[model samples]
Target chain A: MGRYFFHTRDGHREIDEVGLDLPDDRTAGLEAVRYGGSLLADDPHILRHDQGLRVECVDDAGKLLYTLLVTSVDAKENLATFATEKD
Target chain B: MFDRDMAPPGMAIFLAKLLSHSLLSTEDQAAIAALPHQTRRLEPNDYILREGDRSDICPVLRSGFAYRQKITEGGGREIVSIKIPGDPLDFQSMYLRTVDHNLQALTAVELTVIMISDFERLVQARPAIARAVMVDILIEASIGREWLLNNGRRNALARLAHLFCELHYRLLDTGSGGLDIHKMPLTQEQLADVLGLTPVHVNRTLKALERTGAIARDGRGIRIADLQSLIGTAEFSDLYLHRDQP
Candidate 1:
């Protein structure tokens, strides 16, 4: 199982419970969209009215991989505690 | 061409010269000179670029101030940096092929837009200009880092003073500091947004600075009573802005 950390508008997370990070090329492709777009430094397509970044993690190369999109980055501390308690 | 009334003539000419020396290659300038285009004038509230819109044009400020800022996830707005005349607006996205931030005019301004394709064509034809544009972007990133320092570490008063001193020197570089009172188009509310502070805090700080003889405020402008003293109070050094080099 591949491991990966995907950063979204909300926060970062580990994917697949496998702890194996994805390839750089794969990561960079995701990063290109997250950090604005491929051509622009910040995504101009993200309007001012849009909410903050909501990120999710993908575990594999499947068309619809098992991914979890976190809701709010402000809740990172709470999420960390929850993850720890679950573990 | 933008409306000429949008910017001071001297400031416009100065900006063009500075950009010509800094961001533009000789060939790029020649290409720009050869282009037959009209200039558009932008008022204080006009946006040069929005945060998430795709536009095929980027403007070079002939005069006045512009800044990049964003509303954070926490409902916070962080002003990334203050732009002076001659600064290349959105040059980063022009090359990196993406738009990262929103740029808005801080005063009535003039802009000369070069179509993105034409600009890229110029870059492809003149690879050296590409390198220069890259260097300019790196400088902007460095500036962004410094602003992080300012916001995270410095208090309200220090941040305000630092901004004034920084602008004073930057405008001086482009020969715009000769005016007795500089046009500081940003309202205290806007300044608070940029400095990551409340409007009340910004107002109190400005008043305190005025009372302490650090800065003199006259309507929309401010005059530094004592440059060295103001710098001391602000704990500011020009080293970070990197204006000394070309």
Candidate 2:
């Protein structure tokens, strides 16, 4: 069991001080994307790339796990960018 | 209709802007300026108009934020739209008897209300004003269609960014605070209701956007960090807003 904290931001700020237990960091990344999807689902209308939103995941030991970003440069593209220190 | 003194103070402040933008004549403006309206202040979270409440008055948001929302069948509240300064909250009530959504003050608000009967009476008398009002209504309809496009197609990041872009552009008339900052009174939970995202999800999206240097917020205000890139992500186009009407 691993503990992970996911900090979220839309057009504003929200910090996640409490961490949650997940199977692994991969699962954490997936969870964060799902979290983003839920946000997209809730608002009737939404975002832009510069105002685009994202998630940050950290381990219980305060180690940075990974950063997840959803970006779209063209109208036809929606890409997810994930940055992490380790495999 | 009201004379200058009889009109709600809130409505009076926005009259010139509305007249100039709608392209109505001075006499037409006089007609609206004469309305026997009422003004009131609401504490935050107070319900201004709820679903099923049929009111004959159309409210003008003089200051602060108001929200439009509907309740889902599953007993969840979904925010439909946010109203800022100079908006006519529940303008549709002129024709419809039952309100489709609830209007609430998201912050302490000053609302000036004009009775639909008086407004309609003026419209009946002045063909030009009526035409101008119709144009305004059409513009609002177009904005709604754009929102439909936002919800049905855009991804999460684009969805939030698009909203910021729209606000930045709209608030320009309100004397935008140094080109990028504006009052953002809605909490993440309220924003979540409007965005259809949970509070937790909104938190993550915000954190991600902050990390990417897209936006920043302090207290009840938000600033656009990167305009062009944010616009690119949302595929935002101001054409639908019709900000410039010849």
Best by lDDT: 2
The digit string of per-residue lDDT tens for model 2 on B92-145 reads: 777788988889999999988888888888878998877767766777778778
Q: Tens digit of lDDT per residue, candidate 1, span B1-246?
A: 443234344335533544533665444555545543347788886878887677677577777788888877886677777888767686666655556777888888877766677667767777666765766677767777878888777766777888778777767776666223575557776887777764434664676577668788765576787777778878998887677556
**Interface Cα root-mean-square deviation for all models:** 17.6, 5.1
TM-score of chain A, model number 2? 0.67
Evaluated on the second chain alone, the candidates' TM-scores are 0.83, 0.88
Of candidate 2 chain B, the 10-residue stretch with the lowest lDDT total is B174-183
Give the native contact fraction of candidate 1.
0.00
